[model samples]
Target: MQLGLSNKDQKKVLTAFYSLGEVCGTIWDNIV
Candidate 1:
């Protein structure tokens, strides 16, 4: 499945998750 987000958008969302918690790394897809 393709994420409709641009690379920069993807990075920003992931960065937000990373800022929230360490588990975000493992469950990035499910959380968002």
Candidate 2:
């Protein structure tokens, strides 16, 4: 299934997810 986002948009989404994952990781590390 595709969301029909353009290449640039896809890149933005990927970057957003990457940063979000990093943020979550930092929070998890702090909690533990």
Candidate 3:
């Protein structure tokens, strides 16, 4: 299934996901 996103859009999505993962990791560290 394709949503027909452009390359720029895909890059933005990836960067957002990376930032989200970093935030989650920091929170996890604080909890542990």
Candidate 4:
């Protein structure tokens, strides 16, 4: 549902709603 979209969209939703370790590093990079 999310990974298909742009990295921005994926980060926006995941950072706010989810906390799966699989994506933590990716999201952290997105934020910083």
**Top-TM-score structure, candidate number:** 2
Collision count for each candidate, in order: 0, 0, 0, 0
lDDT (10s digit) by residue, model 1, range 1-32: 45899989999998988777866655887877
- The per-model lDDT (C-alpha) reads 0.81, 0.95, 0.93, 0.75
* Per-residue lDDT value at 30 in model 2: 100
Assess candidate 3 and give its lDDT: 0.93
lDDT by residue (1-32, candidate 2, tens digit) is 46999999999999999999999999999999
Q: List candidate 3 segments past 4 Å from native.
A: none
Ranking by lDDT: 2, 3, 1, 4
TM-score of 2: 0.91
Pick by TM-score: 1 or 3, better one:
3
lDDT (Cα, 0-100) at 16 in candidate 3: 99
Instruction: For model 2, give the 10-residue run with minimal summed lDDT.
Output: 1-10
Where does candidate 1 clash, by residue pair? none
Whole-model lDDT, model 4? 0.75
Tens digit of per-residue lDDT, candidate 4, span 1-32: 53678889877877776556657878888999
Top candidate on lDDT is 2
On lDDT, who's better, 3 or 4? 3
Task: State the lDDT at 22 in candidate 4.
Answer: 50
